[model samples]
Target: MTVSIWQADGTQPVREVDFLVVGAGIAGCASALFASQAGRDVVVTDARDIALGASGRNAGFMITGLADYYHKGIEQFGHAAARELWALSIKTHDYWRAWAREAGGVHMDQRGSMLLAESLEEAKELELAARALNADGIEAIYHAADPLKRGYFAAVEQPWDGSVQPVELAQAVLRLSGAEFIANNEAYKVEQISAELVAVHTRKVIFHARYVMLCTNAYSFTLHPYFRGMVIPQRAQVMVTEPLPDSVIPVCGYSDYGYMYYRMTHDNRLLIGGGRHKFFEQEADTTDDRVTDGVQGYLDGYMRRFFPEVNARVDRRWAGTMGFSADGVPLVGTLPDSPRIGFAVGFTGHGLAFAAGTAERAVDHLLYGTHPGALWAGRLTR
Candidate 1:
């Protein structure tokens, strides 16, 4: 995102904005909505159009919490933090569901979701996770044996989790936010000039904004050096089978220790994604959204292994880049040096689970100096 020495040469127009949001993805749009609700005139700008990044390319499973099993999350991040994060995820889902009801046409199916186990050890983990969830008063069904009879060992089902048309939902959020959107606008530099104004230098214009929120996620490294090691971009590959006569699976299924996921689309197509873990070096730390044969081959094997009955042809193959935090959680905070430049990034492939609540907390933090609780970026330093 470098500007050439000769291109435009200080000719870019300077626009004064109230609350300028960089990145029009789901997080950015949600931030805009909350900012607008706070009576700030918000403008959202993106490197690409709205929802064209991982927000659009994801499998659209609305499963809650971090991308780890509940028990594992508690073990990794302690019990209190895990419960807070799970509650935040539910809050995010509540916002999306309310917005969907308001939009009137957004496609959202509350068919619930399942965390199936591909191995015996994972099945044991699933049992623990289900027990932990139940002990915490979270309603979840634990299956000791394969519930789908698809050769899986066990499952943890969340009856409140669901699936969605991600792009449509993002667009609906943008429309509801009523923020002015600028597409194909790449913000190269953001600096707090003086103590009151933040300057955002983009390809189209220079915005002197009162506040700025970077929802860039996977692209966060491109804008600031602080995110270079904090947010690693990993590529995600996906392929959807041609429509079948009927639904193959009634719920969104995540298995193989969260490395692979499959769901039945509204049109009756089987969509499967993941396998980058099989080729870590090739898949990690890059923003290249290109499907690789290595990962796609793994997905092919996965489909055949779990869904041997499907004989449909592959309809399309695509890729996306997910931002993985160094700590396996979303980050929400302002730059310490430039506190006016706030951010909500590093969803770790759980944007739907974390983004809405994170964005709300981010906007409130940036606007009112409130703290972002468990998701505080300062935790990475501590």
Candidate 2:
């Protein structure tokens, strides 16, 4: 599986490996971990340092469901399909828990999570969702009473869901992966040279591998046209307030149907993220990672409205790009025309919940010819 790649100086530098994984995020790191564990020669390269992308800049929620609520998923994807999605979501959560435990268990907290409904209508929606979840043998209890005393009409608590320090988790996973990591090296292009070899061009050098896995997520579109329109890039803003006196947020939680999420860190900082719905048009199809005034303002207003008693100022703010498929499901397995190249992208805004799982599955498909079934990368129509 040796391939020759012409260097910028017109000389060919050939290096052969079993797997060359793009992006050092969670998915990339997980792929490297799985492949290396299976006795494969793996090298993972990233444009920036590990976990610098969305992998680090997320709300740190490790929930056990899709991006949408159970009821909403049923309405949009039908009952049977939605049930399967839920089952997979639970499996992803379990996988994450086990991995975190194996990585020393310091980066995760099993404090559980809740979905708060701010209005009576939203409360009904939570109730319906809880019913649907319980019917599928998952534990979901709906509470009409607001325990946080924030004037929420209702809430649903999933005892199994928890939170993880995303950055720490990613770093730990990278260390445990046992794969050669090349940081600050961005993969610019991937060319299939033969049936079993591919050339990956980066700024520093060209990597030749038997199998090339694309774990770049939102940035996948920049490397190839196959993902240009299929994987739409979206920018999400997030902020962390100064340390509060007590745990303002007792547990990880989401409101407004998982759009706005907040969690209390181990140091008692209120980490909140999500305003994409407020700036839907502005946030869509953009690779810009700059945090805008509009989205930040909305987040601040939301904090004030929800937690008026605590007036903690925002200490830090940033943005991260996420890839959203047309139907919001992640894409996994091999690409359309390039059989030697595989991809795991388009996780929407729920990368933490699905990235590692899908990356492992992609590696399985690439190495053993196993199909990803419903999550097949080529199944995305738009």
What TM-score do all the candidates reach, one by one? Answer: 0.98, 0.94
RMSD per candidate (Å) reads 1.0, 3.1
In candidate 2, what are the lDDT values of residues 76-102, reduced to their tens digit? 878887876676777777767777788
Tell me which residue pairs clash in candidate 2.
Answer: none
Global lDDT of each candidate: 0.92, 0.82
Ten-residue region with minimum lDDT total, candidate 2? 1-10
Task: State the displacement of the C-alpha of residue 183, model 1, in Å, after optimal TM-score superposition.
Answer: 0.6
lDDT of the structure predicted as candidate 2: 0.82
Residue 88's lDDT in candidate 1: 97
lDDT of candidate model 1 versus the reference? 0.92
